[model samples]
Target chain A: MNFQGIFSMSRKDLTTLVIFSIVVLALPIWLQPFGAAYPDLMQKFAIFGILAIGFNILFGLTGYLSFGHAAFLGVGSYTAVWTFKLFSMNPIPALIFAVILSGLFALLIGYVSLRRSGIYFSILTLAFAQMSYNLAYSVLTPITNGETGLQLEAGDPRVLDSMFVAEEAGLPVSNFFGIEMSGIPGFYFCAIFLILGFFITQRIFASPFGMMLRGIKSNQTRMNYTGFNTRPYTLTAFVISGMYAGLAGGLMAVTDPLAGAERMQWTASGEIVLMTILGGVGTLVGPVIGAWLIKYFENIFSSFNESVLHNLFGFLPDGVEGFVVELTSMFVGEGWHLTLGLVFVLVVTFLPGGMMEGYRRITTLFTGGGGDGDKKAKADDTQTQPAE
Target chain B: MDAIFLQFLNGLDKGGAYALIALGLTLVFGTLGVVNFAHGALFMLGAFCAVTLRKILTMQKVVLDEENLTAWGTPTEIRTTYVETWFGDFGTQLVNYSVPLAILLAIPVMLVVGVVMERGLIKHFYRRPHAEQILVTFGLAIVLQEIIKHYFGANPIPQPMPSNLAGAADIGVMMGMDPNIIVYPWWRLVYFAFSVIVIGAVFAFLQFTTFGMVVRAGMADRETVGLIGIDIDKRFTAMFGLAAVVAGVAGVMYTPLLPPDYHLGMDFLVLTFVVVVVGGMGSLPGAVLAGFMLGILQSFASMTEIKAIIPGIDQIIIYLVAVIILLVRPRGLLGRKGVMES
Candidate 1:
């Protein structure tokens, strides 16, 4: 309960907290213009935002680069679904079950993976994640339900339903006590968790513990030489990040109760990595922003087909419109993934510090290009403490 | 006893592919110190080469046959491939063996791709962090796979084995055992033999050639090799090409077994990385040994008897092996200490 000391915040951090709160609260208001007003899209942004933020703690700070984070996410989803199946449709127990199970899973995986550093650690985590996915899709069908996935069935003896009394007509929806965990209410519920996740991550970033992780990232040998045991620090970070992923997964189930084996696939993990790097690795607000942007585009912009493109470019001459549509077709519609890949390449190749660095550079150029001024100092601090 | 023997053979067959992929990965890691996540994409490209070659070879010309008009009042059209027009029966035979013939195109294509990837993108990240290398290469892999997906669509295209080598071969007879009882697929045996030859050739090339020796020297000590005035960079680039060719050929040959899909490369990538790590990073022999060992272990784990005893062991055996090996031997089975530890 005394998390204040862990998340000791400066005045600037408080301002960031206020700003983040405003933006998240404004999502239901201003986001409608951007085509993300719908509850499903809004919930996804919050869910994936949590996923990416959790991923950044280990990758952005410690630089462990576990390719297995999705396994924890998947574990969380399964736990939540099982909780729904057996006992309650309440979000609290489901989330708690999901997070705790995922944390334990992360502990087991991180203990072994952290024993080896650098690429080996990444590969080890990947192997474990893949093994989990393969098992879920095949031999563990009794539990994961194989490719069809584990869904709420009619015969599932949800005992708590009789006690709580089912309110809805057909299938049960996840609830916060009695409040339906769907639609606008669901987005708010997910946002609370995302904000909490962000606050916790911010604290970790500002803590002495976070400083040790930075040391591990910058130079593990130096840390080891200075009488620091790096393994425990790394393992702790991995578990924490894994727990964050679990939290995200739990939130996913809270919003939508289906748990699929594909959720554990390496590509899902890769997307987490992409979100962090694409947004701004090491910058706390960067990954959440990245997750929001990607989900926004994937759900909204990708829906716009050639007709949308034609309408956007209709002001051009008939011949020019045709040419523009043809040229841009490679980056939109069914080609959105191509755009994602290209963005990833360009970001890694040209913008290694990610969009956060780009923002900083532009601000520095505009505000302090003539000299090292207030903007420059602010940018440096932002890089050091990357959270909202 | 016979089941065990069959499992052993199956293990060796699987190991052949694993060893080939791992060897190429370890080679690149040794020579360039780049952890290429795009290696699997290169393998996928190689398999597609066979598909491309067949498509090119069987490009047909349609002609209407007025003399053979149908009852529906339409002329029957005769379709003939360009290759058939040029070389007749020989062209038809070549199409039948397009998988092997793809090697010719795959080697050159893979080499070019490797060179371009290294010269254009990877060279900049040599002094960067391992994370950067991984991120850049991973992005590259995604780009490459997406491009493949864009053109090929998202389905696995099954490739046919050669007509002559389509059925089972009696290896038991050669080994002085009962023939039909211990038969195995001819193509799998061919694949094993092909992998052996390729592996042997790679080792021999490294041992015998001046280029390989210098590359090996560079892998041992890049600064020392550079200070001694050997153009290690060129050799490193060439080694990348060689590694690409190896993976490409492996993929090309494997089309009949796994089928060619845009995603096939990724499915294998995780498993191959495990093999590379378990074998020991930067150690070629270690990669080969671990590949075979894991391959055998995987086959054993997948057995119905084994699964009955230890359910789902088939899915997790490689990871379990990797975890145990890494915890016990931190540097891997044959890896030297402090190679990439920094």
Candidate 2:
């Protein structure tokens, strides 16, 4: 339990990191069998995976639930889109600008929001985020382009556009040097960023800074009593997490080259919270896993209409099949939100550590399940930090 | 000058609704120490109660009118509401007053919903963290909203104002000013009056009644009340129901102003929570005061002169005020020290 050197991963940690990288890199093929290996869905999984990981840095470690994290994502998207609109079609400059701008935005928001803790902190962040969203939709229309969103057009001032070749048909796709950032290439690009994000997140967990954050989460009052200034640490975590969100947003735009104001809505912010909770809050890989699971379900389960249900239950008797499909359809397709809501309630009630805890319980089923008393202690530990 | 007066009137009614919503929110916070994120959902349900009642009262049956002929020379079919068919003129009057009638339906409906919500789900999370309460309630809110959406679809379903009260009231003339200069929508004025009555009644109930006294006492000290041989848990649960009733009635009255949509609850939930926070968490009077203040501020910000001077301020003014208030006075204007901070 010794604090490790900066940038150094222990043997076990390194093994996990490598395994994660391999799995992520091989997702294009591995996920294909699960019927979710399409490039577009893969891209979303990677992009959102990065966003959720960043969110965990603040929420999991510091116990600050930011209901406005979507604002930063929006800020990142707008910045990226503006870069594409004004400068070039290249994603590098757009992404860099996005990260820096959103980092600064988060810095200002965090500085203000971190002035208070608990519900006050949450409300403050929400207020700022809401303001940003409202402005993006209305007054900042010149910058955000209002409801139509910021999209690349046929003729624009792309000063750096001459370096890249335009496509023969339709709008030009975002590129990394000359490689088109669409289809499979886009997934790999996003996957690479996710891996890098995960790696950095792992480092933060092992570092002294991460411990300080954990200390803040466990007891800010005690930390203050012990003479540690918790504000700076928390703010720093907030900024880093914001930048991570910005990077994810940038990646999203890089793949699609569109930025909409709805992306900054409170519901969008709630999605990451749901993702974190569903996977395993504070866990190293839980948020990522959660993100993958949700994105997968949203893509896959939401597509299951009554027809799909009928097809799947075709082997059953006509009356029973019809009845079953009618009932099951309520949990799929447009009813996905209901399913998600039910899952959230159930998970928060029964599995506080989310799906990760469930996984652990099943794995340890033959090993006495750690027994009741020992399991409670472990559960409490995981409750505080779902992932190490 | 008249425009300003009209804006003030506009803000007052809106503020009244905000106050009512915030008052219920603060009630739950005060009594149960749980943030009921689904409070707005209750409000939406209340509004839909009006819609549902109207739909029921106006349920139609088509019959062929042999005396009337269509353009094609076939018998014309006339659709008459069953209420109209059964009760005649009285039923038509009933349909016209469905919004008011919905209050009666919403009272018991909301109480049941609130009790079931508390007993079925929220009861278990009493000992858990505030974060869990928020998450569970938020999820429940979403679920409720989605169910409503499943039944009614996502469109905003407008509830009608009674024909007699649909026009503008010329307050300017009544106040010795130019006629029609300070006119306000009659329904809005009625909403304001209704809100005041509701707010007054709630305060009076808490101020005068024994049940209110017990609830207030429970709010101040839970264990002490329980220690003294009173089952304060049931009282608190009732208080939660009361809060739900308050939110529901507010929503029921507000249907004529803003149409009820699935997302309506969440939309109001954020602003109402802001009002709760800015008023100072768990502070009822503060919630009411902050609600009115923010509502007025929002109206003022939306003024053309104000918007021309500070573009986009209209959209963000309430949130901006929230940010400022939270930073300057984290305990809120009427919030107690070390309430949620501890």
Candidate 3:
């Protein structure tokens, strides 16, 4: 097989890539109207987008619902931060070590966890993650720094940086060569990785390996009976996704420069799952959309105060306005999680394929495209249920 | 010997709570074949029932005293509970035992909640994929916790035990050992006894009653039971309600041991799942056995001597045991063959 030909995308995929790239690159401008254009939130949009994309590869394709991907993310962040402390503050080496280390971590975890399928697999992953979190919070305090988290400290040995440049003042900040990895630069840095991750996911989705993963998802028992060793394929997907989480973690460190044990908590892992399902499982762009949407809701909706609600409902009569504000307040601000939970339930109940399914339904309604809807139904029918 | 005995006692208390929660989870899984991720939320709701009852029982009436003046140069206010005014010492006693009393309130409320949950949401997903079931139930769990948090706020609400059981028990003296060597909290002991009684009642109910027999048969083969002219669905729904009641009472009784926060359910949810898996999925005895075993192991691992050797063994002991058990015996201690093996 020619490697060059294998790497090339079809015209449609190429078009999708180009359009996705443009839209992501223009997020800072377009998001301004929605009040999400700030650097920190934009960086999160890209970072978590990468995280969700990675998560989708495992759960979306292989149907292995991991509750421990956040462990890899935590590993990546810690590795990157340690690199920043020990070596140069350059993101290149930090990212490289982060991905490699997280990949190895994923390999060990996946090898053990993949022995079981269904909910057992999920439990194994969860156990491993919770252990990591607990250990990080207590016994691993020498490395993780306990509840204080790992952060860059001044007067440390920057073995690599010290070779040429003398120590200049305060705490060192992460950078790409000399480019400060903050503000718009950091968002773009994460965006590049997100785009790269998306492209890789798209290629994998189209590849034979991708088909093998999907086959394992559809019917692993049949695959095993047919003399296919599905373990290797599933393990490979797990590692790749773990590396994606690690990369996202590394990006998070680059943008914020802190690694906390909370990053590895099971709830964080659940959030990753939520993003994938909320967007559209098995679709290339769905995870990214889901990540962006959740982050947007978390940041934007949580920021809405009672005064903001009062202003918005000011057009109504005094009593009516007060009631409206009270009702809306429960779903926004501190209660934004309520809205998130409701949306997640509604999505799973109605749109099992998530937003992409909704999009498909809308298009089918307008264009009278019965074929796509039928294909979707067939796919839904074959979905692997968690074994009872 | 004293340390071991103390850890053993501690383990039994912790194990009782674990066993209670795992029993309900396993029951629902066994009867309905549906993994209810919201089981933990039921437990939380139960704990909040106690909190709500305490709030209601202690509702105070403020009266302005015209003859008295405050530092602010205004009339002083006298506060008295309406319960005290109406019923005197009985009301005070009622407020003192609010935690235990919440069990009565939690039973009916949790039954309705469980039935509604089963019929309205869970029934729709019975034929759907397990992944969808987990997702929807997880979402429901989140919604339930969030609603609780909205009313209760983020801080943990403490529930006081009855004044009679407030102090530590001299277990060492009773066992003919050194004084203060094995003192344990009275409430924890009471909790252990309470759980034992509840577990006994549930077992006897299942073993002796016709309803439980049918439910047990349905668990073994739902289609077969249904074909034999029994409405297994209705029984399963009842079983779900019973499971909720068990979890609710466990939470209600546990408030004196640990304060009830909205997030309490989630924290227990992960551990309870591990316990269930370790106990073997769909096995009631396995869940109970594993719960006690893990609880004891955890308490022992937290002993300074053990921690001295293994360093944070206490933090990860249960998970480590779970991992090892799962790896060594895929079906767990008492797991039957072909249950969730696919």
**Best candidate, TM-score:** 3
Candidate 3 Cα lDDT to native: 0.92
Report the CAPRI category for model 1: acceptable
lDDT of 2 by residue, A268-352 (tens): 9988899999999999999999999999999887998988898899999999998999878778899899889988888887787
Angstrom error of the Cα, residue A306, model 2: value is 2.3
DockQ of 1: 0.47
- Tell me which of candidates 1 and 3 scores higher on lDDT: 3
Cα TM-score per model: 0.94, 0.96, 0.97
- The regions of model 1 sitting more than 4 angstroms off are A1-8, A166-169, A306-327, A369-388, B66-75
Residue A254, candidate 3: Cα error in Å is: 0.2
Error of 3 at B256 (Å): 0.4
Candidate 3: chain B TM-score against the reference chain B:
0.98
Clash statistics: count for each candidate: 1, 2, 0
TM-score of 1: 0.94
